[model samples]
Target: MKKKVGLYFGTFNPIHSGHLIIANYMVEFSELTEVWMVVTPHNPFKKKSSLLDNHHRLEMVYKACEDYPNLKPSDIEFGLPQPNYTVNTLIQLEEKYPELEFALIMGEDNLKSFHKWKNYKVILERYSIFVYPRISKGLIENEFLTHAKITRVPAPIIEMSSTFIRKAVKEGKNIKPMLPEKVWKYLDEMNFYK
Candidate 1:
């Protein structure tokens, strides 16, 4: 049997506990052997100016994922093309890791704009999609995906975000609970998000 890897693509400006919880939960609940956090340099839907340096984000993800052995933080987007699209990244990953099966891992909010994604149909056809529920986001109720192979992961919804952590740090608020020990150490030592 092939190892199934869930590709959790994001611009993890700073990976948080919520991200860790979701990725970890997906492993035990879904058809995933491991969850690979694909750090995107830039996403088309998000603002470029708000994004931190790709290296910094990748490093932070690496630090955050240190404890979870099944959680692999990937810098795959760094070597690939810019304005990283999910389809392209998945294709490249499949090419490189032919031994493993890849599935797109995302939140329900992302699934809300699934139709807006470039070549979304191709992505659905080629790879399976595992969507985790968001605290504030609604369920997946798309008409286009009437017959799509989408798996709803019953992962616990922790209402947290990198943006919230950054804002808290900027204001000199306590953000220790929101981050992993190693990640908090890296940020505290480097004086990041200040």
Candidate 2:
């Protein structure tokens, strides 16, 4: 049987415990053999200035996921282009690694606004999507639902977000428990978001 891999893409400005919890849940709940945290250099919809440097963000992710053997940090989009689009990245990954089956893992909040993505229809047709609940309202719906192989996983209700973390750091507050110890140390050492 082919190895089932989940491509969990995110900015991961500074990976937190919430992301890890969802990732662990996805692995246990789904057929995924492994989950790759594809660190996106830029998200077309989000503002650039709000995010930390790509390398810095990637480093933080590496530290956060260091203990998980199944979790990996992929820099595939680092050299691709600015304002990375999911469709384009998927195309490249598929062409390069045909032996592995890839699934798109995202939170429900992203699903609510997924239609705005470029060539989103093509994406749904090409790969399966594993949706985890976010702080968003309502269920997943729309034209793409019928075409895509979709699975909804109920993640732990930890409303921790990177935005909230950044705010706390800016205010000189401690972020214990909200983030991994190693990640927090790295962030503190590097003085990120300060």
Candidate 3:
């Protein structure tokens, strides 16, 4: 059987526990053999100023996933062009690891806007999508609700956000509970987001 890997792409400004919970759930409860937390170099929708350097974010992801053998930290998008699109990243991953079957791991909130994404149709046609639930306002398109490739995994609804974490850290709040121990230590040591 082909090794099935779910690609969970995120900025991971400082890898937090919520991210782990979702990834852990996907790997443990779903058909995915492993989950790769793909650290994005840049997200077109988010401002660049708030983002930490690529390596710092990657290091945090590495620290966050080190104890979990089934979870991995990936910096594949780092070498790709700036403002990289998911479709492009998927294509690159396929080229690099031809033997592995790649799937997408995302939240239901993102599904609402999946249609607006660049080459989203191509992603749907070529790859499977594993969607975890989110507490968000928007309605998911009916097409996605019945889509063949999209599978709704009943993972825990984690209502955490990197922006909130950053804000708390900057305000000198003890946000340690929101992050992995190793990640919190790294962020504290580096004095980031302050």
Taken over the whole model, the C-alpha lDDT of each candidate is 0.86, 0.83, 0.94
Q: What value does the lDDT take at residue 115 in candidate 2?
A: 79
- TM-score-based ranking, best first? 3, 1, 2
- Among all candidates shown, the one with the greatest TM-score: 3
lDDT of 1 by residue, 126-193 (tens): 88889888755555555634646788878897889989998999999999988999889989998898
Query: Poorest 10 consecutive residues of model 1 by lDDT?
Result: 136-145
Better of 2 and 3 by lDDT: 3
Candidate 3 wrongly placed segments (more than 4 Å): none
| Root-mean-square deviation of Cα positions for candidate 1 versus the true structure, in angstroms | 1.6
In candidate 2, what are the lDDT values of residues 119-161, reduced to their tens digit?
8778777788988877877655566466437777776766888
| Backbone clash tally (model 2) | 0
Q: Residue-pair clashes per candidate, as listed? A: 0, 0, 0
Candidate 2 TM-score over all chains jointly: 0.93
lDDT of 1: 0.86
- Each prediction's RMSD to truth: 1.6, 1.7, 0.7
